[model samples]
Target: MKHIIPYIAIILLATVIIYSNAEKERTRITERCQDTFSDAIRTEKKLLIKQFCMQYRQENSPNSLSVEDKKDWYDQNYLIATSPSRHQLDSLFRDGAHKINRNISTAIGYTFNGKNYFSGDESCRKSVIPVQECVYRKDTISTTDIALQAYIHIPFYVPLQNTYTYAVVLMASVALAVCFLYTRRRKKNMTGIPLQELPETGNVTPVIPRKVQTEKWMKLTDGYQWNPQNHMIEHAGKTVILRGEALRFFQKFIVDKHFFLSYSEICRLYHLKEETNGAKDRAYHSIKQLKDNVAELGIEIKSIRGKGYKLLFSHRNRQII
Candidate 1:
């Protein structure tokens, strides 16, 4: 029984050793595959590597390879060869003979049989010769070896399948469409002038030097306006008339005083200062007109609730001519 036990132990040990050796050989083959084609894969032709693995394995290890060995041989080579490197192929090859550690790689051209080796080749001799010298020199040959040609073509098809450029074009087209719609609305509004008849300037009385000073004061006021050029007290436009009598009165007050006044203060001077509409319907219409005119230029009139309406100019607006 004891003798049988020892034999069994020996059998297990042999099995372990055989497993380890097989694993090492598989790893070595994978590394050799990568070193032979790393430059080709990185140059964006990875299909060549897959083809090389498939053809090389079928020819060299047909019946011997287990499922795991077959998968590892191809997958490992694909990963290592396709990885991005700090330097490009032209630069790495130009450096002339770089050594990758055996822990990370297998010796180049160490396959079961060298791809270019012929059975009767004198240089190889088949018996005592090292495999390295007998293998075809990659530096001298620009063409891919027969085994790798198909695998290296995979990257070429990747860019054609990409959809990002189309998405960018779609977004740009949508933005252009929005701008076109807004411009059409504004042009329509501009052609039609509201309240074109001149109101009586009579009994409105001339406030001379002060009126001239008010014109200058309007220019220095801290506010943005849709038509700053036409905001002078003397200037008249359709926008001002549609605002009812309050805007005209507000203009009269500023001209009479020779300076700018806040909206609420202007409302008070015109006796339409209350938020209620009863005595102040003119003031409400005036404020609405100002907001609408600025809106045409892509600007907004934002009311500060307790304060007053402020003309907010958008940076995107084209400066009014």
Candidate 2:
């Protein structure tokens, strides 16, 4: 669980980065399309103007129309040839331009002759380009103007279903590899012998007879004796009855010899809380009573002030048992 959290965070970070980059690319493409469409509209208008001028000149060459009349004719012809009504442009964009780039849809709008004309999807206005105003001029005289506004709508791309599956498989592989290596390392550190392959033979026990001697009593000093089986201590020919916490505390001193037993060790052995009410006082009282009980046997329990407690005894007084 601890190891999986970091991997999950990494996967999330990667997903965010991928999505951000994809959105940026989509925006860039939309902007490029808008610029291209604006140029196309300007180019188309210029062509229509040139064509109308040539036709007008040819038709009126014999009678020779006035300049104002030519300008009016040019405006009318240019508007008719180049400027489709909003409805017509909308239909064209929906059915024609939309098919050109399936990934990116487009919308077009025109302000021609002081009337607004718009075409294509209404929802695709987010990436609208600035209106490109194209003026029709002949010999330095302004005939008319048309404004083209274009919008390129690029939908965000999402990864296919296989992408998620691949990511899951990758994370699982990493987790399994880490777990396998950890288990191998742990097993390598273990100490053991295989018992299943032991040789089958008779006389597995030692053949030579050996003498075994057991001590019946353990002596702390010349006048003190301890009976392990009975759990009794005799001092100066008097048996001292010690039980429960006292007996456990005395057994620690016996086992550890002169080594200090810290207050924490004492608390753990006695199942006592170090921070409980009067816990230290209770421990001190118990030690005082134990010292009194074993005083006649030349044994003493000494406190090392803020450190711990230790049993004071001469090593030469140790019994065989």
Candidate 1 yields a Cα-based lDDT of: 0.37
User: What is the Cα root-mean-square deviation between model 1 and the actual structure?
Assistant: 40.3
Which ten contiguous residues of candidate 2 have the minimum total lDDT?
Answer: 131-140
Against the true structure, candidate 1 reaches a TM-score of 0.20
Candidate 1: deviation at residue 70, Å? 73
Runs in model 2 lying further than 4 Å from the true structure = 52-77, 80-82, 86-100, 112-114, 121-146, 158-321
- lDDT for 98 in candidate 1 is 29
Largest lDDT belongs to which candidate? 2
Report the C-alpha lDDT of model 1 over 1-321, residue by residue, as the tens digit: 432554455456554655555455444433333333344223433433435434444555435334443453344344335542312332332222223222221122222223332222244333322212211112213242112220111122222232443444455556556656766686688776664666766586667774443222243132322223445322223132223333454344334323333556645643443543222333333554554444543445444555444443454432321
Please report, in order, the local distance difference test score of every candidate based on alpha carbons: 0.37, 0.55
Give a tens-digit lDDT track for model 2, residues 54-107.
344555454432464346445544555654654333444434434445565656
User: How many clashing residue pairs appear in each of the predictions shown?
Assistant: 9, 0
